[model samples]
Target: MPSVIESEVLIRVVEPRDLREVYEVESMSFTGSLTYDFSVFLFYYVTAHDLFLVAEALGRVIGYIIGLIEVRRREILGHVISIAIHPLYRGLGIGSKLLKALEERLTSRGALRIFLEVDVLNKPAISFYRKHGYVISGILKNYYGVSDAYIMVKEVGASLKQF
Candidate 1:
């Protein structure tokens, strides 16, 4: 089953029409965490569409990643604002593919580093980020208004590792 899911995965740019499904996946992915509302997704889509991506399987949206790139302190930084793979799609390499796609897009736009915050208690997510070469940078207290989060960063450019 895992092999079959992996084989049919397709990565593509996020379109306005995909927003609903994207939000649905996000809601599912971060059930207890702070998932953004539709309005927030719209704001990001309008401003940072290039950094948004979605993964599809059998023509259904199965996962997505929303990112933002900004030039801060003269260094272009990419922030993984949100990423979610439907629970059913877990362990099929979709998350890694989505991350790689977003990183590649950011790198092409001269981003020097990529960062994201993960719930401190989500060990699987923490491990996943580490596996992709992201290191813990700091902690944000009350990141979800109830729990803390760890900021993880991965250097892009020449040091970026391909999955």
Candidate 2:
């Protein structure tokens, strides 16, 4: 088997101009109506603009991740809103890098825990989160209309480490 080359993936804060390509990557990474529309992305940007991030290689946007923070009572909760990588960029560790970036940002802002919802059928994503120390907290019925979703949670300071 040939060795895998880990390309240089530059992670950075998302800019207004990057939305088009980010949406394209999001569309490619998901199927059916699960893909987020531009308006939803815009809403996330407007609400948590500082938490939006994108990964680039050779001047092309290859992956992206967005997060939201909420302070409930006294604890800061971090929510992984969305994450996607271009089909060609999968298995290159770009997603991992992007996730780490978001986690670091959340931690810097004093997030106590981080969580996300993933489609139950997406085994690869479930495995990825599990490797990152996320546990299944519960299930969201009909999270995607006809499909259910798994609620995954990870304690920020415990599991998310610098890479």
Candidate 3:
């Protein structure tokens, strides 16, 4: 989590100039989102411009989440590929804020719902989404080339059913 330093923080779309910093975060974050032998994160960095996002604190990039819309079943939905916060900055609500920001971006693009495939072993992320109103729709076997994927979804607005 980021410190309560009252820094200027903003969430914005990924721009060309941000590629370097974004890649640095990607390289330091995780492998699935890395795509190209964990190098520069080029698989999506160079391919999906609109799906990338960066959270800048002060003048440095602090957090980021990558997502894109893809066909599931017969409809299109937003899928968050990755969301990471600097190790020292964990527990600051950065990941939640980034997810919400991505949801807004996906919604503006006609996405009726948002979804993600997270590692079943990633207890924190799964707990975070489940607590944030995301339900585990299903589970995919070896969805990420090596591990299973927990398919989670969150419907836009409100639903009649409440836990």
Candidate 4:
């Protein structure tokens, strides 16, 4: 089977066995005021199957998207809790691919929309998500300890280019 990433780095669902790399990417990609501890990753990254995703390059995972499901008044949605790509692999479409995969999975699971939050100062991420059809729907005041966040949401099943 062809690897998910074109450069032999495959984007795949995060399995229980991939915890070490997942945690490593989680720490390496996220810092400053909002880092989740290893125990939190271990406990929440998987529940029966997976609550996370990773991009693997030559047997090593270099990126991940961690998230959860939500429901309100019987409307279910997939929330893209977090996403990251290794510094070495930035700008190679890895983050976009991983995010697309997550959205695909969530849509297949009957999620009508996927939402996420980005730091107000995260220009690259905001631009990336906007490119992928996620729009800023609202903002959270003091979303983080010091920084505000833009809440973005995208409806699933908008468009699919050829494989």
Candidate 5:
């Protein structure tokens, strides 16, 4: 049940040339210390290119999601490092599309579960994750230096049909 605009967005792996637009989306979606600069995006491109993806529409980058796979106590886990859509494209289902695309990629790579941290004040983001089956597992105090963050997780095992 995606809208026409949502249908037009193409989710694809991140490329070196997409970093500038991705950084612009990040800057528009976040503020102050919460925003990651171009260098961080470049680092992710070099270290975890496979898990990073972008949402392109009309030949321009409109959103992106960054993820990483890690082994924790012998369990392979997927981490959503960051996700953002341009301010003008907020409620068109682009974020959900980006998230689902990343989740499928991670699950295909043997991730048992997926995790992400969101600012406690971001109600829209929290709601978005919740709608996608993520639940708050814990809280990180002062995660943003000025506020707290909620650690959200969703299982991506074989039993989950969405995966």
Candidate 6:
């Protein structure tokens, strides 16, 4: 079931003005090397505007998800470059909303599969992805320098379901 807050939250394409608030969410959600610099967000905004989205509630940016579409070996793939919800909004279904919106956009753009990397130690994230129908396909050692990461993938077709 969706929470009242989730129902109130609006998911939309990210605007240039939302970058700062989006960066704040990113900083709050991650630390050290895991956090992306503001420039990286700007780059994504320029290069993948259609794939960048934000969750707005109460007139502020509460979360954001950035993705990229790539063609490799005759396959169109979607990559979730980054996703983060403000600490206060973590469990209200905002992340799921952001992810669902991204997946829809990617699939429409011909993405046959979606991929993301999560730290091996992040159990909550692993479980979240699993619930969304993603499966761990492999592991990348030293993915985070100080830690490893699990590469998870989900096929984008009739099997995809909404959270």
Number of the top candidate by TM-score? 6
Candidate 6 lDDT over residue span 1-99, tens digit each = 223477899999999999999999999989899999999999999999889999998889999999999998999999998889888788888899999
Those runs of model 1 whose alpha carbons end farther than 4 Å from true positions after fitting are: 1-3
Write one digit per residue (lDDT tens) for candidate 2, span 35-137: 9999987887788888999998877788899999988888899999889988888888888888988999998888979989999999999998887778999
Which window of 10 residues has the lowest lDDT sum in candidate 3?
32-41
Give per-residue CA lDDT, model 4, range 32-140, as digits (tens).
7677777766767555145477888878887888767788679888888888877777888888778877787777777888899999999999999999888999999
Tell me the TM-score of model 4: 0.87
Better of 3 and 4 by lDDT: 4
> Which regions of candidate 5 fall more than 4 Å away from where they truly are?
1-4
Residue 155 in model 6: lDDT: 92
Name the better of 1 and 4 by lDDT. Answer: 1
TM-score of 6: 0.95
Lowest summed-lDDT stretch of 10 residues in model 1?
A: 1-10
**After superposition, which runs of candidate 2 have C-alpha atoms over 4 Å from their true positions?**
1-7
The digit string of per-residue lDDT tens for model 1 on 1-163 reads 3434576888998898888998888888776537788898889889887788889987778998888887888988999988889998887788999999999898988898999999999999998899999999999999888899999999889866556
lDDT of predicted model 5: 0.91
lDDT to native, each model: 0.87, 0.87, 0.74, 0.79, 0.91, 0.91
- Cα RMSD to native, each candidate? 1.8, 2.6, 3.6, 3.5, 2.5, 2.4
Give Cα distance to truth, residue 57, candidate 6, Å: 0.1
Which residue segments of model 3 deviate by more than 4 Å?
Answer: 1-7, 31-40, 72-74, 158-163
- How well does candidate 1 score on lDDT at residue 89? 84
Number of backbone collisions per candidate, in order?
0, 0, 3, 0, 0, 0
